[model samples]
Target: MEQSNTTLPSETWANSSQSPAPMGAPYMAAAMLLFATFLVGLVGNGLYLWVLVMKMKRTVTTIWFLHLVSCSVLFTLLIPFFTVYILLGFHWVFGTGMCKVLSACTHLGMFSSAFLLALISLDRYTFTCHPIWSRRYRTMSWAQKLVAGVWLCSFALSVPYLVFQETSELESSRITCVDYYDTSRDQDRAETQAWRQHTHVVLFLVRFLLGFLLPFCIIAGCYSQMGLKMMEKGLARSGKPFKVMVAAVVSFFFGWLPYHLYYGLTLFKDLSKSLMGICQLICIAMFCFNVCFTPILYLFVGQTFHQVLRTSLFTLVKTAFYEDLDSDGVGPDSSGRIR
Candidate 1:
């Protein structure tokens, strides 16, 4: 799932660049999660987008929610492209530009989501703990500016990846979009390999640092401080908002932790192929679920959605938990009879 891993050792990057992970549960999980997440995530994110845009007015909170759901919606819309690619055995017939755009959008959405979520958490903390300052300073215009800055930074972070990704024709003639990492330079293997190693370490650190570690810490810290402040002020007695915040923070952390771990450990590939393979499945599934389901988990965990019917467990979960995910029972093979 990690297209460009610059944290890998030079030797590993050179030797394992073309090697796919051992196919088993992780590979299958990726396929299943792709389909399932797309199905559910699309509906959930779409409904949320509609609600945030059409039903709600512009505010600081709405601005944050707008960007958060926007990231999820963009990721969900791209699912069909990836689902097709996976079903076609991962050969990217989508061409080089499509590949770049796809990867760019994904990375951008991911970065934006993480950053926006952190900003939202911080906003909540300030609104709760420092109400005076929040009332005085928090404005939709300011939030909009912040959101713009986040998008710009996300785009910048993802551009290198977009540039590096290309369609590679394997010796077996199977073409897949992958990061070539400029290993194609006229320089000898040693020079290119050295470059690969250097760039990988830098990229790995940058991606891991900005994309996950730093954001996670900030979100966790903001919520923790907010929770403590609310508890002192007796507002934490409600418990529901705390639960939603917990869900948000936990979902973000768990969703992408495996992804970071996989790439981080890929720097040392000889550790255990089987273990890494299994980790991939967990990572991909959770990550996919996060992109689509976190909004439901966070936004609806505190609210009650009216259940339209008693259907399967999936439908029941979607119904009682969040109508946004159901979209009237749109499954692989289903009647549009959610009612």
Candidate 2:
């Protein structure tokens, strides 16, 4: 989520910076969500990365998929930081550098994921509708270059967090990490507050537009064209492809919409804490869905899910029944069929 550097009145800050209360339902639930998501994301993305890197043959498709899984894996690595921060009652024991780095990394993960999804959608469209052009230009080198470009773009978008995020000591002597735009200590209070709000509004809009809206449109449009092309060619007669296209677009949109909206609502000074907490819970749920389930969707549709599933299942069954199949002299015939 994009950080909003809104400067509220001192009373609001005092209320927000009060000593950590007893762990409530919301805090417990959020911590659990982050923990569970961290575990699932680690295992799932790790397995997929292994398969992509070690088991599957390299291709442009695999290249795109490899980097996408890498993003999830890298992001999963950051979840514990959040889990700890939540468990600490929102106090940030991590140094200011870490606060900035974590904020930037979180946004980097989000932006890279969005950009990769959009890239994958466009790649699918090209391969489907312009096979000749794709054959000529869609090479491993080109894919790598494009993926590098995506990372660069994501980093560029996230640098503002590094500049704006810092640890602010609260009224209770506890430290909290927050985005703060006012750096000039000598500036007039009113001017500083105005500049902070202005920066917040500007970065908020920039983040939403570039991070969510633009990539979303690209994905939706590319998928739409692909669907139409498939229909014209009779490849979409089964309706499964159309359903997949719709699911891809819907999942990407809904998974990230709440994250942006939650931060957007934070711009309002009068928003209740309870409502914000609910919005945060929704954001966490959606974040988990995006990080964990999105990869499964990608694998199911584009990564040869059946083949991988069958192979893994067969290996597991064979390992479990090794003696039964081999010791009884009933393993296989000369033709290699199971006896």
**Evaluated with TM-score, which candidate comes out highest?**
2
**What ranges in model 2 sit over 4 Å off?**
1-21, 181-188, 237-250, 298-339
| lDDT for each candidate structure | 0.63, 0.65
- Assess candidate 2 and give its lDDT: 0.65
User: Residues 58-109, candidate 2, lDDT per residue (tens digit)?
Assistant: 6665676677778778777877876776677777788989877877877787
Q: List model 1 lDDT by residue over 143-231, tens digit each.
A: 88899999999999988766666666766666666665533444668777777767767777887899888898898898778778878
TM-score of 1: 0.79
Give the TM-scores of the predictions, in the order they appear: 0.79, 0.80
Clashes of each: 3, 0
- Which predicted model would earn the best lDDT? 2
